[model samples]
Target: MHGSAASVGPAAADTPSRGTLDELDLALVNALQMAPRAPWAQLARPLGVDAATLSRRWARLRASGEAWITCHAAPSQVAHGALALIEVSCVPQAREALADRLARHPQAMSVELVAGSCDLLLTVATATKSSMTAYVLALGRDEAVTATRTHLVQHLYQDGSEWRMDSLSRDQRRDLAEAEDSAARTAAAILAPEDRALMFALAQDGRRSIASIAAELDRPESTVRRLLHSLLHGGRAVLRVDTAHVHSGWRSSATIWMSVPPAQLVSAGDELSRLRSTRMAASVSSEANLLSVVWLHTLDDLARYEAQAAARITSVRVLNRAVNLRWIKRMGRLLADDGRSTGFVPIDLWAPVA
Candidate 1:
């Protein structure tokens, strides 16, 4: 539930300080990771803080541009077919133009300017194989794009890599359990060190059995079972939702770029969300001019979305729709960075109920 979109590697250390996050901050973040839209008062209450402080901290986090709340969807479940990671080699000067073009595409999930092999890494999903092929061919037609390499996502274990939330301590865990007395425990905390060791091993191969986990963790099979169940119900920590790009029926998926007036954004976004085809939409900060990204299931669905947008926002731009050829690796790292995920939690996604 706690999600991040961060740059990894050596520069990862050079990243700016995240500021001091105390017990309350950690608690609030964990609550939000579970439900990003939870009410300020609700999150505040459990942490023994007031609404004002919670609101202030949240605003600071947002203002600092270190944390955000975004929606994620299962493309296959939405009837979109393929998924792909695109690497684009472009002239540094033209990178801005290329980014702008890709961001407008309805097929892209996320895009970033990297420092390595490819200047840009674009995650795209599409509806059908034919559509995916067409989308790629269109990119080839772009004169600005010198070369492109597509990596089909075979499977997704994790997505996003921002670490705005802090890890938890033992006392903090007890406090959480006490505060939310009736809530289910997170799956990550149930494992012993040995069990966790096994989990790490099994994560590399999802098919790893309890016996294997036990052997790896040097624990008994019974302990492994208990830990596995805990991981399942405890916020799904040990295992995550796994799916291939093209499953039984769904064919592909795509990212939709949108432009909206600053004034009309709230109202326009609300209206667009009423459509069933839209899985998730968010206002993002990008180097390109585009302001928003929407995930859609089908091309017809996309057309309908455009019509709706025309009535809501002043103008809508369809940059380029990339196809998701396959799913690559997904969320797999330890949350707390202590070889355990006990202390790491994300904020809730939806607002708390009255």
Candidate 2:
């Protein structure tokens, strides 16, 4: 049986959870949520643990496939690019096979099996709108796929990077904040053309050392460090520590589409952002102007969110809500049946879909 740490929120303090991880592991994941690549030595002091012990704990967590870290091109920097959510319908009994097939594609950022009108849900990113259109057309050609509904994202109000575990102390957060701000300020807010290769390398393994990345890029360690510092501090890149949500008590999620008055879109988005269950919320160019997703302890929890959203937000009409069944892939990592990382596909949002 899965233990209590898998329980959403938290169990009582007196409850002992023989779950996949103890309190320490959760704390580590929380700290990484703040500074994913902070040196072990720097992180140790903040967590009140030694560098060596912290390293060993991370090793165990990674080896068990209970947790991992990865980075992505920041949504803000890539706001000009084509990013959309596609609801996919498959032919009879072909959902799982098609989901697995699409999950391996580099442009398919995250693929989920769902319970609703569509058999699969896909989040795709491409360098241009035309390229994304071409990819969708290509998908329509697949014999297993019957229908698809695409929603072009208009604006992102919140993303997974902003979600935190809230396990760190004030002092710990202060230390981590200082580490993130230590980089020398740069004039440019986004990565230059040359930072592309380095950015993708970090996407592959977010925790890779500066020396390791330098060797891969065939550059001096000092130069690599400077570029990395700018890329991170400039907000052109995002690093997040994500576990298999199935293992985290947040076993299910729901995607909500809404039609809100133009006057209330910003306020609506802001309201949705502060919801505890919210993982992502954005404005989309469709009949439904607002789209949001929420994590829940069980499949039934979607109703509670829908009820609350309808009552709280101003004039928000719920167009539809679909419950996600399985995350076949997330942020380029393909998952196994039990939510463990089996492999990775290097996502390339900078490239046109060919």
Candidate 3:
């Protein structure tokens, strides 16, 4: 189904509610967006609310489509090759259908409809230059996709804080190049098809041992170990992580869209990267000229960070803040191009008591 093109904003008091969000709702939503694994107790603590209350609020938010919580592996991590940001210019009338189609495609990492020169922004991953060309050609086949332009991700300048902790304090942020030089180099070779198949199998059940992966792929254990070493070294992929969140206490989270002046983007973003609560920050494709999205751990932190970033950077606009209410999908394995499931497990949350 097509999502509404309407931008989010508060309306008149007397008007019937299209959708109304409360402060607590925003805080809870933001918290879950960052760590869907956080327990009810931890989520409740910061708000001075009980776990039961947090659970009740979560249920209501999910019922409304205000947010989605899903664990998604970076596209290149699961596949090999390049990741690109593609902007689509479409007839306003056809926007809905275009968005819906793109949303269902397996290759889509994320999609957003915006107001500006382009209507849609898509994050796509492909294995080779030829595949990238084929992908663009495929878009041309769709009537709704009128015109498209793309930017290859020279590097993932920033991946949002959703999946990884990007916003670590000065002492907490470690230099990747220094920490894993050999692993990074080896990961390039280990990301082959056989290796992916092995990973795909392990992804389903992390408890599976090297022997198990070897048996499944009909490869020797030594070979599997070698492949895994390469993957770890290359930073191509990571083993599954056991994640938890704050039902034990109070916490909040937010996704902030910022418009930065072109000249100040690098310096400004680097400064933001040092904050304690920022889990992730990335430059993304937007219909608006907005340059970045930052994830925060709490509403208070979000407010403070925005004020600080705004003060330091004069070149852009912080256009929209979407307080993600709840995440519907956690980690789940996606289907490979061959139609086999990747064995990704969604972080399962225990149902809150009534």
The C-alpha lDDT values of all candidates are 0.45, 0.78, 0.49
Q: Give each model a TM-score.
A: 0.41, 0.89, 0.50
lDDT of 2: 0.78
Number of the predicted model whose TM-score against the real structure is largest: 2
Compose the digit string of candidate 2's lDDT tens values, residues 252-315.
Answer: 8889999999999998998898888988889998889999989887878888887777777859
lDDT for position 154 in model 2:
82
Residues 1-354, model 3: lDDT tens digits: 111121212122343322445667656555554334356766565556898998787654433323323322343442345556676788889986786566555455445565455777665655455666677788877888889977555434334432343322233223222221222312334255555565566543433467877887888899887876665445655443322222212134454566666666667666556555554455544533333444444556667877777776656577766543332112332222221222223311111111
Ranking by TM-score: 2, 3, 1
Task: Give the residue spans of candidate 1 off by over 4 A.
Answer: 1-27, 75-80, 161-165, 170-354
lDDT per residue (tens digit) for residues 162-227 in model 1 = 111234455544545533312232122323444334444444333346787788667799988776
Better of 2 and 3 by lDDT: 2
Model 1: which ten-residue window has the lowest total lDDT?
Answer: 336-345
Report lDDT (Cα) of residue 49, candidate 2. Answer: 92
